[model samples]
Target: MIPVVQHQWKGNLAQAREIQVFLAQKVILKPFKIKPETVLAVDVSYSRFEKCGYGVAGLFKVAFDNRRHKFHIVSEQYYTNSDTVPFPYIPGYLSFREIPILLPILSQISERPDLLLVDGAGIAHPRHLGLAAHLGVIFDLPAIGCAKSRLIGDFLMPGLESGAYEYLRTNGKRIGVVLRTKPACRPLFISPGHRCTITDAWRLIFTFCDQYRLPEPLRRVDLMSKRMRKQIEKK
Candidate 1:
């Protein structure tokens, strides 16, 4: 999809931080959740060489019933792209390094999703504009961040049960939630990217997980990215 708002991507750490500060102001934490008929999950997998990676996006049509509170995946579409990383990976500024490689894949998706689930952080970043937030602002679409690890902030461990969560705070402001997606597994860090609220992100993340620690869309795309990267490297 074409970005609704385009901005330069190549920059130094200082410049990246400045962009983050500017974009963070645009992130809307308001409750913008909808009964989405489609969702897209995206992830990028790196090769042994840090400067090359593959990106994959999976768009799925879904049906959700409030009475059952269940989501059924009706259909799926996939897209993939490989690119040479333009910048070195830096903590808290990962989007700068990865987004350049991922956008091509995102732009080629056959269908636009009602919601975008990013395999990264949102307001959970030190600058409050992580990968998800950055993409949401650029796309002008609702998005959520479902991270495997905490990029910043501190919180008590959530209970050892599915759906348990605790608020993650930074300087007395709530930024995200530590949500348990499966029993006896590590919890995910759920955060609002843009046009979505913390609670909405949490609930949708739980619904997407279905029976795994990672959401189904994320899981499938992660595997696809890895496979794509390997195939590209072999060529």
Candidate 2:
């Protein structure tokens, strides 16, 4: 597998291979008043011909009412790098290549977020470590990893509610959960990043998930990242 781990943010291929444990490490095992004020989501795009992935990060604040939910993309960052992804596309080290760029963009936000919703895993990893967990560790902020597919663990099955979830554990340790977002829709791979427990992660994700499979803040960000990538490729 490729082992690209960049620390200098120089877009160097060699730097992208320094496999480190994680970039962030704040673990949130308890619950707190999770206000849906601000959230951030990150996604990367690769140039198949150039052998590199460009990262585009989006941070949006939620504007909610009794009738609906909406968001405004207040900040975004796009950067190019030669990060050769290592680790066989595994968990734990996902943030090594992507987060290096993401963290820089996140740090520049004018307002600190109440919560961050990552596009990868949180605790649902082979090492019980995912991108969200890594970011939480580094930032010491409450965060969640919401993935579209399963990375590890086993569960009985989720219900048809918007927030129904089943715990995902490995080696007798609770990692993440298989959660139902919309009734009859595919489940999301959810996990706590740091300073958060399984239950808190579930509550937070369920709240932001709202009526979409992903949180309003992140759902739009995902589309924004794709657009950024397309623009970058066109250049």
Best by lDDT: 1
Candidate 2 lDDT over residue span 12-81, tens digit each: 4344333233342224457656555666566665555535555555555555444543333445443333
- Model 2 compared with the native: what TM-score? 0.75
- Residue 144, model 2: lDDT of 81
Local accuracy by lDDT, each model: 0.87, 0.64
- In terms of lDDT, the poorest run of 10 residues in model 1 is 104-113
TM-score of each: 0.95, 0.75
Candidate 1 residue 159 Cα shift, in angstroms, is 0.8
Model 1 residue runs over 4 Å out of place are: 65-68
